[model samples]
Target: MDLATRATPLATTTVHRAGRLRTGGAELSWHADRTTTPVVFVHGSFDDHTSWDGVVPLLPPGVTAVRYDRRGHSGSSAPGRTVIHEHVGDLVSVITELSGGSAHVVGHSYGALVSLMAAVRHPELVRSVLVHEPPAFPLLTGDPVGEPMRDAARAHVITVAEHIEAGRTEDAVALFAEKVAFGERWRELFDGPQRAMLAANARTFLDQFRDPDHYALDLAALAAGPVPITLTVGTDGPPAVRRITEILAERLPAATVHTITGAGHAPHLSHPAEFAAALARHLDRTHLDRTRPA
Candidate 1:
């Protein structure tokens, strides 16, 4: 119940490069502490490390949490091309370099998809992955609503892309806020504070949505790969996010799917306490599982 203790300030570290990879050089910003195993935070599309502002304070003691402005966003270097594999490779480099080999990876939205790819491609560099609403449709093949959700996601991406190309980032962002971020009922929920946060990070969001390969990756294949994974969806999240979470839970081996009550897509931001508590519990359980007698 002591939220104060969970609100420890995470010290920011300077940006560092993780050797040369396919996308030239990938850089990351890290926060290290003396006690905890490093937990790398990956931001979703249209956002940067700042997206983790709320949840950072809630992370457990000794945990080294790192967030990077995935290539082309914020302070990180952008190498022109915006392919998904390149982004995945950037993640691989960051994790391997920062965690000293492996890390507990947490990703939201598009970042979740990248995290899955990194885990699968370089399993040795990932201990466990906490994927929050990865938009992988094919994995939910059996679900009646799966196809529709995928179609919607695709359509949304295309619409946003066109808007961005036409130099209408504001319009694209507004439309996204209406249909995706705050759906019908919750539109009113994003009053003063939430709107401020969204507005501040609007540019990054626009850039992410406009990227060419944002929706081109094979999310299902990435999810099916061998990795200890945790899937989380907010109870009040959009139907598409919930659907994606369900599909991931069903497809991933050794995966646990959870719905955080009274939260939305950005639970880490909207409900920091609940988000931190759930993450802490998951990390504890994961540690126990790893040390348990086989």
Candidate 2:
């Protein structure tokens, strides 16, 4: 993971278009409008709606970028002991409420996994999906080569979970940033607010792993679904992330792969302009003019 030639950080914009959606005994907080040509941005673990602050403002004019704080993170309610499907359901509900049934979904890490599951479960709600580094670890289980990777990943997960459970959330955040998100450069990359956000939501990361199907995905169902997909990876990311992206591109019938040069796990944060342009291209090629905003 080389950080010597990283792209200049984009200027952060303050978007005050905050709103809340009450669903299934929990409240999901989100930013931006419910306009036509909606592109919902789902943030990963230890993150909130502002994860897309750099990328959202750069999208084309016709595109409405909706970024939400996933349930139990940031401004969202923390209903105790939830599963991955609930996150999936929350995403589906967001799309239905804001986009009038269908929208382009851009997700990162765990959020990417949630978006894919929603597409598989309710294809009609997702016009297109552009996901970066979904940790679908179940896809690695049982294979001779993947078994070792899975084992190592499991150990890392347990260590992070233990740190959180022990109330060493700051340590957990630093450990995850070092091992998964950003290499040693996490401290340099994450600003004060970004680091605060990660620390604040550390417990939710542990809650996610409590679900039995946290990393499981039915590849067979995803392959049979009709939703278009653009699976993105960073050139300099961890090998495990690359492997998961390859697995998705191989298993999903309508999936295409995109690579961001000199970027790591969170390109939307590190390489905002490139990430945003890639998303815009995916949406434009979808030819969503039929549902253009009035």
Candidate 3:
């Protein structure tokens, strides 16, 4: 059932459960709403499983949305080290344990990168992928058109790093919000709980950012993979992010792009209904494609 046609409120209808998974030497906190089709959600840096609260409840009835706090964030164990490959392993483990080995994946920002890498590394375990702007900046290295964007990102990184090193995590989070996530009107966009969440996970963001290979992707491997990918971009998102998504669509043969009008980085937070509807469509399309004859 679509969001509008559904009579019962998700609060009353969805069954929520809490669970744990051990991966990459960290005990990860996971949540699931028991249903027919598993749809795992991967949240970006400086965020946690609660990031999907707005969207998951609104998803169609059959989707069992599973979301977990990544290592070093929220309830997960913080090992003081964050690596992209470990995150990919964590995602695969999550899928294996919670989703019956294969499931549709949806991710935002850094989580998007993890989900894409997981799809490439374990195509047999991924049904399909829906990702918002992944900060795969390495893809822009040699492109002349991306030089300016790269420069701007580097500057933002420097400033954010300075704040983090100075032990001003709140300041770093605010700077990130103003510059990348929410733009000029960030103060109005982020609420107290959301801001607290970002502030709390600030150090993890720095840890991930410092990893040299965190933003790298093997485009050739992803292109050759069988898993279908959907790259989602918000109309009001950062220009660099939009460019990265554009480059990804150009490179990945089995990938498609979708835009959410007037939304920014966290569309699931800012535009839950639209995001949920888009996910529902993706779920339907993947099911149809898999069931269709060759």
Candidate 4:
């Protein structure tokens, strides 16, 4: 995929407004308002909450849209050797402080796993969970059918780490672009924030990969849990990512799946209006607006 071929057909603009929230040990930078049923957005690996900028305004004006820099991402404090628990704990505190202990949540890629885990660990804090293409790789483990996929993915991570440890940051970045990101298409994203964010948070990606719980979760427990989850994928998304959503939907009967036509990977960026609509509909259906301030 050449960068030209993968380039967005339209020139999209962003609305930039920034503020900071004092949460736990880190002062999280965010954009939001105080409202009963706030919407909290979590960004995937190598990105910050501003990744939701284009999609946020399209959400219903009646609802509050909140996003923040996760630890180690842009605009957030970088603590030493943080793990999945710390990430989850940050979200728990943020939601409690921002939305009075309950809010609708949307997470993309790596953030999707974090959001789902938050719901699983603290259902009382979440009114709904929406995820896009989370690489829940652990679900591919143990079974004869999925074990190979797991091993291959783990090997890929290890190789990328090895490259970085060799002090070959450029090599590691290129490998990540070609292997994990969409090959030459990654260049299209590099012209903006994606490339810089990936570079800035490279070490945290290492920590995330090393964290046993980074991609590990008990799907059965989640499936039987109370919070309703909706998983969205782009129609043109990679087969592996589509498979993750399929397996998750199959396991969690309460889960709903939506395909964004003519989009891939990042729907919030590629198909902002549709993504926002889907999110608003889910929140309305779930009556998240009814959540009261704590």
Candidate 5:
């Protein structure tokens, strides 16, 4: 069933009779499958829930699924600056309304960072978490590989913001794509969605870089937080992606790390089957572990 027909868990949440609802700085759109203990997926920058189209069918049976647009992405409305933490708050609301407080959360790229922060900030709501290649740039500050990653990220963000600010959105998106090494592969992998995402989300990316703390998260809080998190990165992914995951995993050594052998940054798009299977297995294991007597 869609989130529209569903009665929300709380009256405090700003929900609309329509398929849209108010959350933070945006009117968000959400979809939900009709099972319990939902698995909520959060998309990265410039993407909406539909990006999970390829992976949804492959999920384990009997578990509910939910996904939503962040502020200013896809069907969601945005009226203010898009701070990353604001996205975190939105995820909290989505999970609250969809799962009545608990869900296995999965997030990709920038969304991954938001998931981690949400787990830390609202530990009661998350059962387990999986994140793919979140660009947690602050983790790389002292790393040899991470330093270059930071430099590249800073350069890319500044240039992209400049272009967007100058009303050169096409040029800004081209530069952003180039920085990510989008190349022919991004076009080939995403079909038309990538271009559309960039055009729709150029301004969001502008505010994404406004903070020096934009990419920074309290890693120690994440490591010490109660939720069990799994960091997933594609083997063929860039150095920065892998390094960020590695640093985070090292900090949370008890947490798991899984690699998709042939995959790249956008594993759901580039390697949907593997990504879906891994997530399904993790959910299975988490359920089994929870049910086991300690």
Candidate 6:
């Protein structure tokens, strides 16, 4: 299960719909396998569907894995306003159209926040949710721990907005990759190719930053929902992210939390085998329960 090699066979394509506009005219791209239950993949800020490039093929034969560019990112429609709720709406529409019903959802980083919101809002449309390192800082109560991290996230968002307004997307991406993505491990985890991808998608990354609601709205609703969720934090993730996972596991009803060993914020990219194995196990458990005598 060499993740880099597995990524090669995964195909890419764009999706467009004229009748509905969740994110003010949505455009999406995805990777699919015709034989499986559709698995929708959502990426965080600064990346596109390709972020899942390293993990898509590792999915079993019966799962159709789909990843999309967030509105205003990559080939997706560029909406004038960006917000987390809007992104969640876009996901609902996309999932409805692509999966023909509720589907299994996997979201990474900020994308995880969006997916959680969708589950909360449209629980009927989601069978199971896998959220990897969602930054739900404002919602994590009982913690003075999140105060500094939340402030840092806020400042980082402001910095990104300022840089983008100043037409400094490259610098914004660099800073985000260094300060947010890999954090202390930026030098060790992000290779030449990863850096290139981040640099290329700087504008979209900045879109999320300029609009604080891109994360805030989702975090607000995550605490109120009853959606069944699987929360994952990379063993090497930032302390804040790990704390958020702990909060969800402790607070969210019907939620399970797990940590991926030897992985960071992006385990799907860094340790595809372990990531896929975890997913497979989750899917198996859920599927069995759904079919059990009731």
Name the best candidate (by TM-score): 3
Using lDDT as the measure, name the better of candidate 1 and candidate 6. Answer: 6
Q: Which ranges of candidate 1 are over 4 A from the true structure?
A: 1-23, 26-34, 140-143, 184-226, 288-294
Please tell me which model should have the higher TM-score, number 1 or number 3.
3
TM-score of each: 0.78, 0.90, 0.92, 0.85, 0.88, 0.83
Regions more than 4 Å wrong, model 4 = 1-18, 22-24, 33-36, 142-148, 288-294
Off by over 4 Å in 3: 1-14, 288-294
Give the TM-score ranking, best first: 3, 2, 5, 4, 6, 1
Would you give me the overall lDDT of model 1?
0.67
lDDT of each: 0.67, 0.81, 0.84, 0.74, 0.77, 0.70
Model 2 compared with the native: what TM-score?
A: 0.90
Q: lDDT tens digits, residues 1-294, model 6?
A: 222222235533223222323444665554444433667889887777777766766765456666678776666776465777778888897788777777889999989988888887898898889989887776654478777776776677678767777888777766766676666666565678766766666766655665657555343455566556788888877777787787677777667777799788888878877888788777776682353234
Better of 4 and 6 by lDDT: 4
TM-score attained by model 6: 0.83
RMSD of 1: 5.4
Residue-by-residue lDDT tens digits, candidate 5, 189-265: 65565677767788888888785566777878877888888889888777777888888888888789999998878
Poorest 10 consecutive residues by lDDT, candidate 4: 1-10
Residue 252 local lDDT, model 3: 89
Task: Give the TM-score comparing model 4 with the true structure, all chains together.
Answer: 0.85
lDDT of 3 by residue, 83-112 (tens): 888888999999999889988999999999
Clashing pairs in model 5, backbone N/Cα/C closer than 3 A: none
lDDT of 2 by residue, 1-294 (tens): 111111234322223356899977789997764334678888898898877877865666556677788989989996787678889989988998876788889999999999888888888889888999999887777766666776776787789899999999889999888886677888877888879889999878998978888887878887887888888899988777788788778787578788999999989888999998788777767776655544
Say which prediction, candidate 1 or candidate 5, comes out ahead on lDDT. 5
Residue 258 in model 2: shift from native, Å?
Answer: 0.5
**For model 2, what is the alpha-carbon lDDT of residue 21?**
96
